[model samples]
Target: MDLASQIYERKSCRNYLDEEIDLDIIKDFISKCRPLNENINYYYEILTKDEVSVRTPWSAPYYLALYSEEKENYFENIGFVFQQVSLFLQSIGIGSCWVGMASPKKKKSNFVILIAFGKSEKMTRDRSSFKRKDLSKISDYEDERLVPAQLAPSAINSQPWFFKHSKDGFDVYQKKQNILKRQVFKNWNPIDMGIALAHLYVENEETFDFEIKNDFEELKGHTYTGSIKI
Candidate 1:
């Protein structure tokens, strides 16, 4: 499958087989990742399991450690950038899972998140396996384009993304979570938004353009993330 098809087929894989992967293909793909928020400074390193320390019980042979300067939308930028890499990994039949509870053993102040990747039998999911909200639940109205975004994986499935459509494009937001959810996934929400947007980008590669705009109408109880024309 091509990159766009990977969006639909990709699964957040946890269970894996004892298999090997070619790192050179991953290295080349990482070099070419197109950042959704290009203004933010970010970097990543693919490290072995020995280099990472995890709070989760599951493990992988390799982990992709993402780091970025703590600036506006840094986490979001990291998500948008590396999620593309995740899709690329999927295209190559490698499996990966976003490891929010993990970090490098020698963690830097700039460290953001880890994506644990290895060869797995469960690389793709049937559409029935995808437990996602309908388009009406995520957007203000019907839009088939939002289907891929609907399928995006989020931390604990707290799919906190909202879109308000307009004639020009659509404005995206991070839906506000209550105190209970916020305590657990406050940082993950923005990254989730970026991951959702990454799916839209993969689907509409030629026309995806994102920018922060001040003029869009306010979305009640939601924080403005960005606007996109695609």
Candidate 2:
């Protein structure tokens, strides 16, 4: 399936069949995987159920742990890379979910995120089934390009992103976090931006150009993440 199709069809799968994915297939997928930022150093480790510690009561037969060296845009890079993997899993009939609350028992590196994946009956969902903000609510102007972004997933479904479009491209920003939610989402929100960018790429890969702009003035209540020039 195409990325756009995967974007519309994919759903978070928490329950899995009692089966283990073939290591060769996982390795093959990893070999083809490319991080959005190639300068960042990262690695992936496949952990069995016994090796993971989940804060909640969810269970999965396998967990994919992403570890990266601390650097600029590390979490965002992980989100971009893993989002691609998530879509790929959906295309290949595997079920996956971004498990932010789960962690490895032993810290090998800076653990960014965990993805739970395996064979599951609950895999895909119709496009109408996705509960997301409308394009107008997420972007400053109406542009069909932002549809996939509006559907991008985030921590607790916070959807902490906003976009302003211009002739040059779109300027991306993170919504201001209130005092109560700041502590929990400060680090996670950037990753959410990366996820949104991944969706944008899936929707417009041929023309999208992602650029980080430090000189752009921050909006009154939002934090600027980057810009996408098409």
Please give the CA lDDT of all the candidate structures.
Answer: 0.87, 0.83
After TM-score superposition, the amount by which residue 76's alpha carbon in candidate 2 deviates from its true location, in angstroms, is: 1.0
Once all C-alphas are superposed, what RMSD does model 2 give against the true structure?
Answer: 1.5
lDDT of 1 by residue, 1-230 (tens): 48888887788988877677899989888888888767778888889888999899889999999888887777788888888888988988899999999999986878888999999988997888888888898999979988889989999998999889977789998999988988888889888988998889888889999988878788788999989988
TM-score of each: 0.97, 0.94
Q: Please give, for residues 1-230, the per-residue lDDT of candidate 2 as tens digits.
A: 48677888788898899786776776686777656678999998999888999986787888899888887778878888788878888888889888878899987757788889899999988899988888888888777878888888898899988999856989888898999899988778888888988888877777877777767867888987778865
Q: Considering every candidate listed, which one attains the maximal lDDT?
A: 1
lDDT score, candidate 1, position 113: 89
Considering summed lDDT, which 10 consecutive residues are worst modelled in model 1? 35-44
Query: With candidate 2 superimposed using the best TM-score fit, by how many Å does residue 51's alpha carbon deviate from the native?
Result: 0.5
Q: Which stretches of candidate 2 lie over 4 Å from their true place?
A: none
- TM-score: which candidate is best? 1
Question: What overall lDDT, based on C-alpha atoms, would model 1 receive against the true structure?
Answer: 0.87
